[model samples]
Target: MLERSTKIESPGVLKAGNPNKSLASWQGRKTEIAQIQQWLTDKNTFLIGIEGIGGTGKSMLATKIYDEIADFPKRFWADVSNGAGFSDLARQVLSEFGFPVPEQETQLVEALVGCLRSGQFLLIIDNLESLLQPDRQWGSLFYGDFFQAWVEDGGNSKVIVTTRERPELKGFEWLTLKGLQVDEGVALLTVLGIRGDLTQFVELVDGHPLLLRLVADLLKEEYSQDPDLSRLADLGLGNLRQLLTDSQVVGIHHRKNVGMVLVLDASFNRLNELQKALLLNISVYRGAVDSAAAVAMLPGSSAPEIEEELRNLVKRSLLVDKLNGKRRFDFQPLILAYVRYQAGDQSEAHQKAIDYYRSIAKQPPWKTKDDVKEYLEIFDHFYQLQDYNSAFDSIRICNDFLTLRGYYVDKVELYGQLVSKWEEIGARENRNYQAALIFLGNAYDSLGQYQRAIEFYQQSLEISREIGDRNGEGKSLNNLGNAYNSLGQYQRAIEFFQQSLEISREIGDRNGEGASLGNLGNAYNSLGQYQRAIEFHQQSLEIKRDIGDRNGEGASLGNLGNAYNSLGQYQRAIEFLQQSLEIFKEIGDRNGEGASLISLGNAYNSLGQYQRAIEFLQQSLEISKEIGDRNGEGASLGNLGNAYNSLGQYQRAIEF
Candidate 1:
């Protein structure tokens, strides 16, 4: 038998109406109630563990148990949110249950147990995980003898503990509570004037009380109309997630304290400018990007400093990711949206990309002149994408290379067109129609503007041939092949590819050889010659591999996979895509990886593996959105819709 303490009623604090109070007029959680009541009534069980997700009304559940069990001599409530030691745990429980506080760890549990044995008390321990916290020396505070002693000997009254984690306590009856069912969630929502059908929604989230309440809050705030259940059922929580920003009221009691939402704001205020930028920069990754990739995205930081900050985020639970693995770290979606809103004001990402492009532009041209054409090529890509700010900035920086030193015909043409867009000019240079004609031709060919493409390629090819530049002539032929292929003129495309291949092989340019081979593969693909297309692509892949051109090899592999897919060889297609995906990730080619994911998802969709298809497509959509690839994102979204539709989840199929 255990000792006992003086009789006392469970403390009934009348501070429920206080503005900052966490107390609620609780109602549901019947299962949890029954489980704990049984645990308390059982004589064999010494420890009772109550577990639930955040905001699942865990505190209220614990509070109710404290209030209801009246016959115990004393009742104590210990908040273990900070993780307590055995000594601290005994002291807090004793204090809350109206037992005298013991002065030292050696006598703390004995004093409490003696009081209990004397027929005085029961203890309801709050935040059970908090008792796991250690002192500054980094040692466990409550793992051994005392914990066993409390349960085995402190007999007369029972002890109950609540935690978010599944604490492995011996002789403890663990009761895990997830979120409410569909009906319960809806009731909770309806009570707050929130609206949603939620009938067809796949409940991936464990009905965690906080998240349910958040969804309910979002429904009330954003989608208040359209009574047809079909419309409501069609939408998923993802839509709600998008609409639910930081300021909006979240889950169950939408009016309750939004303390957790403010955690990021406090975290932001605590960090310096550099740390803020570093954190925000890393947040833009496709998935849990490894530390090395994060460093690559941000150029200036040292490894040790970044590692320290990353460790800080992990400890604070701001950035959740496995410390090891390839796709290891991700900022929580809710947190990421907030960070994106904040980062737009501060990051120098655009400026950095521009600077890097300029540095690459400064590299010595192999056969071409110092025309700064490489920079123009990159600059215009950004320009056409409406990344105008970076384009304009780069155009300003490399105005020199675009002018006097530029002589390569393609570059000269690009320079003329590029300078024509600028409003400012000190010494206006004459436009060389010939060079503009050449560059514009090549650009049109690259863009699949075949008529425009053909016109430019013809013009450039004639000039290069006249100038005795066989290499330029060969490049023009390659563009001619690409343009013809786009126009469904496979015969013409093959002719051009053949000529280009001959010239490339004659010149011993391995890169040019791979390009010509890839071009021929494209021609074959266009003509529906699946086997021939794959063979050409494999030839291109070999050349790319030998030349150490990872980009070219991945492209060839992707093309080969597309061929296999078209032929209904799903397994082979998947294999090729997986290979391409590996290379893309290894080389940090997010855009390539996104495309591969889409292709793989499409293959899976064809095989009727809808869940896996949607999974991969969803990942693809996220990656594309992160990399600013709207086209890829849209394609993935459409595929995801199809997947849901095929699964008979019609309501979740489409979103306008």
Candidate 2:
């Protein structure tokens, strides 16, 4: 029932840094690899940061690059954990880099700096965040005596840091990662032997590589046992990755997800005050927050403080720009979740931010443009509330708001709503679509979208003609003729109007025929064929008289009088004009009566009955004023002016 998709693929693969170090199996990231290699070779580059969403294969890329460099006599791996102290990181780096570690802390530092005198080497630091944990006494190694000595002396090491988040490194480079391409993603899944169709692939993996691998491993296991069984039954059946510190095989995606979380928790425990606060705020959201909005939400924080904080976060590889216009700061899901957990202890600020947006959604629109937006916010709120009826109504109001602004989308959406409503009432397969056909046609006409209107009108005519509903067929044809008339195709308009008139006359629908005749007269009038216009107007007037349609008779009589007046038959015009006025008066149509009275006054003046003309014109002008017909009143004033011009009383005529 849905239409085809219209999304484009990214040009490269994203790095989803994992907890337990995994083997490299990557695709679509050669460009990124080449860029990193070039930067590392350049003298100006100090650190290369690896960043991406969870399951984006960040760790895999790092290990692949590390494996390619076989000549490095020593390669080191450090696990970032909550309990990881400065001493632990120093121990891993010192032991793996061929540096001698002594039992005494001071002896270890001297030997580590002595080992640093060695030549060019690659330092692969994994989970760099664990270095800043509160328990890790980051100051002891970062700024403290032992680590301070190494930092001052080490000048030949190329450090590459990989974290689920960017860590707060004082001197390092950063690279934010993206996800894998569709084909690369498929290739990754295929390597695991869960070969499946598009529908199945999307249903199972949803482009999350770890979940894809996990889901595939489960299905593969199930398929190996019972090849004939369905694949969906194997979902949520296995754990693929565990903590770097723990060795456990599980049977759920959430457990693997949580395992990654624990790794992040361990890393965050090591940060100093400024770094900790930056990471905490950066992980505070799922959607990007405007740089200003984020700073505003930060209590007691100044603009310069927020900008500097965010810049440090970016430099550390914990936060990056989303490239989306509305938001400036973005975080990985896992990092955000961990930060949120930390902030959960102080829930007031977070809850207030949510309330601010909700309040914006509830504000009343003060302009037509804002009116549409106001309802849209209400619509989203109701959708979040799971109140479909309220959502539907608010959206409907948005449609109307768009309509008043000449927007086409809201009009199309409105028609869709009406169709849905009809279906809800069991009218989808309508046997009597006379009402729907006319309404849809008229709606299309209002938009000047004539094709749909013509199609609907044709279908309506066919159905009404088949059911012997002449009135409906005539009405549809008249509307079709109006559409042609609007396009300046007078001949086609005449053709459609004639058909409608013939049907109405055949069905004894006098009022319908009269209306059709009035349309035909207008078409003829537009053609400048005065004789044909008079003929049709006469026929319409006769029917209105026979059917006792006083309003219709008054209109037809007035039109006929205009026709005669245009022909210079002044007396005949007066007769018909007076006749039109009597009907207009009988029906209490002040506008119609005023117009008729103005015509009578003009005719009387033409007959040289000045006093009578003035009396009738004054009466018409008063009625015109009462009925808000300025044109009619103006015509009466002009007639009175003409009467006084003839009598040399122009001032009195203007006053009258």
Candidate 3:
């Protein structure tokens, strides 16, 4: 399987705001509690804003803090999830604080203002994001003159506003909530008595308190039917995501009753049609989107208008900044699920995204550093839609461009899915099915799973032979040889390579012929047959040159260098490696460039040119790191260490 650069955590949590709460039962949020208490007791702070995504424990934290202040006699709490006007809010506030509810809107505002100014009071405004409406006649409760007057008055009063979105108004002390610690999240699940080892899933929820609680409750019900917990074990993080909003499972349990859709709908219902369109369109992309890509996705909307809407969505906590301060955004998983379903049949929008990305995939000379991320993103999106055509196309490009770019884990998963999709779509004898199997084989081979690689390659070979696809059969045979070579079965590898070479010649596929020739050379080299390896590499090089395949030519030259290095012909190895390195650089194939540098380093090391070996190895390491090739980085580091060891710099080698 391919490895990911970073393991992405699921949606984040909002911590408890008061220390007095039972950590044993509710789980620990000691630090957040301490901070909120400090702000509450401080004379300088008037308004405190608690902001986080839905199910992140915003309301829980606010309520905990509200309960903590036992002596603050004039206290009130209001739920604004149902849209309420300023007059209605003021009436509720005054009535809750033991003041008479005035009949007129003007009288209610006067009474609420008078009550706040008269004494120290605590006003907890729940769901402040829902109250933000540009068209509402009484939308100014938080943004207008009255709220400003309360802050300016600086009386013995503190107002806590719990919202998913951060209010635009200034002078408020903000406490942005984060996910809970692993231990706290585990404790929460333990308290719920969910019959499963949920430690792996703790990070999946990003320690969101409500999500943890709800998932625990759901798992409890599931485990009641089957106590083994193995039923839930097969469920991945995506399935865990479904559990959060699964109405059958979630039901009306505490904060779970509030529901993900209800929280999102508050902000969603307020968005203009264009903004809604933009959100729905972008939700199809499970990966990050930069401003330019987002703009391109919105065809008819003006650039400025789209930009403003994106900003608004960010402010409303609908779209989160993926690259902080980079104007790149991605939706929270729950929010994305909501938008994907609620945005009303976005097949056209999905088709638009597919077309745009597929066009990018078709463009040649894909710059590795710039285009790989986009290709991977598109690959993921296409796979999610079960669009096999686009998925295979995008992933094929990604296999070439991003195979060494530290996306092997993602590729393994994608290719495995593609294999299943081909089977599901009844593409048993289709060329794409063989290709998917080959891709899966390559992924497993990269991960050093030679047996798994062989299994896939064998499957591919069977399908190719069944369909009489001579070209695919050749490719499958060559790859089978590679998997065997990796497993140290050099004789077996050579047999497969010879078979592949014969098939390629029969089919007149010069590309396949050169590939099988190069692979045969590699198998021979592994078996220590230097002369035979050189002969095969020379033949492959000739075919590559005749066919004008510069990339293949470079690979053959590198293979020859490797063979020479094995034979202790250090100078000869360096000569071929230098040519290969130049060709790789000229072609902007960083993976190839890095491999050639490693070869040159090994050649120098074999010649006892330790200093020169160090130089080449260091260059390889730099290129590997720059190109995000972790396996290459590891190889370069090992080579560098070996060079340093030869020079008697043991400590320096250890550092490397």
- List per-candidate RMSD values in Å: 27.2, 26.9, 21.8
Q: After superposition, how far is residue 393 of candidate 1 from its true place, in Å?
A: 11
For 1-656, candidate 1 gives per-residue lDDT tens digits of 00011110111111111012133324467777888777667777767777754556666677776766556645656543322334445545565656675323345557767766666466666544433322212123333455577677867677776665554446778787656666666555456554345533314333445544444433332345632323333433234333333456555333222333433454566566766876777654333445665565566888677766676565444565453323245553345556766766433553444454455566532221224544553455454444544554544454433222222222323333443443133112212333444455544443345696687678667767776767776788988888888889899989999998998898888899899999999889889999999999999999999999998889899999999999999999999999999999999987789999999998998999989988889889988767545456667888888889888888889650
Write down the worst ten-residue block by lDDT for model 3: 1-10
Candidate 2 vs 3: which has more lDDT: 3
Model 2 residue runs over 4 Å out of place are 1-416, 419-433, 443-455, 465-468, 565-578, 588-656
Higher-scoring candidate on TM-score, 2 or 3: 3
Q: What is the lDDT of candidate 1?
A: 0.59
**Best model per lDDT:** 3
TM-score of 1: 0.37
Per-residue lDDT of candidate 2, residues 448-544 (tens digit):
6677778778877776777777788899899899888877898999999999999988988888899999889878877877678889999999899
Higher-TM-score candidate of 1 and 2:
1
Query: What is each predicted model's overall lDDT from 0 to 1?
Result: 0.59, 0.58, 0.70
Alpha carbon lDDT at 137, candidate 1: 24
